[model samples]
Target: MTNKTFCVVCKRDDASVIDMQPHLVRCLQCGAYEIMAIEYLQMTNQEQDPLLSAWIRNRTEEQASPPLLTSSTWISLRASLRIPNLREKQAALMKAFARRSMFPGTVGRYNPVADFPLAWAANEGELRFLKQDLIARQLLDNEYTMGGSFLITAKGWDYLDSIPAGGVFSDQVFVAMSFSDTMRTAWTSAIIPAVRQAGYTPYRVDAAPHIDRIDHKIMVEIKASRFLIADVTEQRAGVYFEAGYALGQELPVIWAVREDDLKNVHFDTRQYAHIVWKNERELEKGIYETIVAVIGRGKSH
Candidate 1:
């Protein structure tokens, strides 16, 4: 008789077979494997087996939690997850921490155990798995403790640099404006067209098909955009926040306001040059010219 085998899914030898069946095994690691003889053969020949190929693809996808969509900040750091792999995700997370640690006025080293960005993880368990994986691979320095600090190893930096560009931040322009009927007309009739003429895609948060946390989505769009066009015609607080955030990221902000409403613009922002347009034609013409002058054709930064 042959020796009892391990779970085929996770390769754990400790898993027990169902009802003493040698062909069917349960996985202890993921608690998800219930392998039949045919399924086992299919899994082994996944490339040649269509059913097993689809199952494996689906299972691999299900491993990623729903709420943990990759963010544009990861793109800006040149660490976006282009391929679905543990090492890539770990590298992106580590690079995010490294960026925060280098931020102006940052006093201490990043403590990933305590300071892992929650926005990047779906839950505490997912975060823990990432940390443990990195530690196991010797890419991060620290024990699994509350006060433990995370310092990337030299190998970790090499891994980060090895990641290919994900191109999440393409030639895109984020448009910030009021959602009123007039502003909507302005955007659809003038702003968006001008952006396209300037050779960049324009995106507005309200136009997105999927409903998500509004602020979170907006921030993601801002980070992904090559530049920002802020129309403070109504002086909406959200518009101001978006513009200010873009400026803080050192992204170029193209300020605009209605000719009549220019007086309502904040005192501080008024210091910068702005496009004061009286009508849609003026808005379109001014924005197109400004984009051509400020961001030149074919340039993404």
Candidate 2:
């Protein structure tokens, strides 16, 4: 059974709380997420509500359930969650249609008010801008109206087709991690296998074949790959740099750190969630779960 109540995350009244161990909430605005009673009581993320709300909204992927947020995940996600840029949001909206449409030219009408979060917009007006831009770019129908059917154009189909298929070209994932002698076992046993298990090829720049200037090559590899995993165990400046570059490219980043070393993570980035692990086994589980949650299972999964 589900009980109606205001959402703890978004404070929206249309939320239904499932009667269970860890409270499971389904909110019209924030989608569905599971939170522990203890974690809820200890929550300190009130200061960053907007970002958290938007993050929850975006997690309502095609059919995936919302991720479980313990004390650990909430902090990492809160620290790293950012409002996507306009172009990124536009792409997301189109990709959504591409994935959800049954066939080409399938007519769809999404509510600008109720579905604004689908495009990561703050309000209906921002979502209107997205539809307007798509209409102008010939990605959507040319009609101008407030509430009506929205259709993806033939050009939109062609555009989505031009994107990489079969996850063929972008299956590689760049790993930004320390090469510390202490981390070798974790690298080989934990991170690499976890990525491969998730169906992505992991490429650590250090292990890749490269002839260009090291710095330039790192950036090139990052740009050509899918997402990146950043482990800041040793506080390496290079790891931070690569992670920042990937963020600039608007790629998903799964952050991880050794539990013992987590306290040393930079103050600016400590807010973002990092899979803090005391052992390689914990690290592997956290990394795999996070990859599935943030970017969905890769081609291999």
Candidate 3:
């Protein structure tokens, strides 16, 4: 907490601040997050964006370490930040309720003022409106007390169950790699089976029967996939480009390369851990373990 007395993300002054190794700011509006003083001070009041605020609030609600924001991490996050559409916001808010009230008819308190970020709302008024909309739709019970508590209706659970695993990327993994004659074994013997073993659908754009524009199809498939596996074995520009697009969408990208090609990776992406393997056997095992670690085993086998 710099002596500034206002939240770095939303500029709300009433937030609780703890000056520590990574300054902890428990913002009622933006939720809790750890930020280095340097980065906190670097943010100007004009930099506030609700999408960024909502994402931080989401990380806080996950009950994991509050996401630590730094210059490097912000580059991609800031670029990826976009206002979510109305239906998406409502879906997120309902999912938040589902997280709290696992079963129907369980009351959970919501603070429109503090938890507005949960709905990706710009303010408390918007959050109130969203709540009322849900109530009107019979997806949530009306708040019973002044505390603004609510419960999901049975219909709400049904609605949630009907939705996909995520707004984007529903347990499908997009594989970005060289489709070269030498790399044939890498795709068939390594990447494909590795993704399948991790319980997710492995999709290589070329493997699909799409007569549409290839680039359009690639972009569409990338958005539909949960994460990306970028095998830079041949250091192909297409693989790097696809991985960059995935990063911009905030999808996790696992890096892999042939041991001999490891030295050829681009300078910017070199910082990430690479699963350098001597052969397809090692590549398969490495990619499988990394997928399990980065993203837990997917439900769609």
Q: What is the TM-score of each candidate against the true structure?
A: 0.49, 0.54, 0.55
TM-score of 3: 0.55
Q: Give the residue spans of candidate 3 off by over 4 A.
A: 1-4, 142-147, 166-301
lDDT of 2: 0.75
Candidate of highest lDDT = 3
Which digits, one per residue and each the tens of the lDDT, describe model 2 over residues 218-263? 8767776788899999999999999899888777789999988988
Q: How accurate is candidate 1 locally (lDDT)?
A: 0.61
Compute the lDDT of residue 218 as modeled in candidate 1.
76
Tell how far residue 249 is off in model 1, in angstroms: 1.2
Report the number of the highest-TM-score candidate: 3
Q: After superposition, how far is residue 271 of candidate 1 from its true place, in Å?
A: 0.4
- lDDT string for model 3 (1-301, tens) is 4443588778888887788877888887777777787887787444777777887886566443466777667677777566776777788788888887746777877776778888788878888787788888888876642346788888889988865543332567889988889999888998889888998878898887645678877876786678889988878999999999999877889999888888888999999999999988999999999989988897654
- What do the candidate models score in CA lDDT, each in turn? 0.61, 0.75, 0.79
Q: Candidate 2 at residue 32, lDDT?
A: 78
Better of 1 and 2 by lDDT: 2
Better of 1 and 3 by lDDT: 3
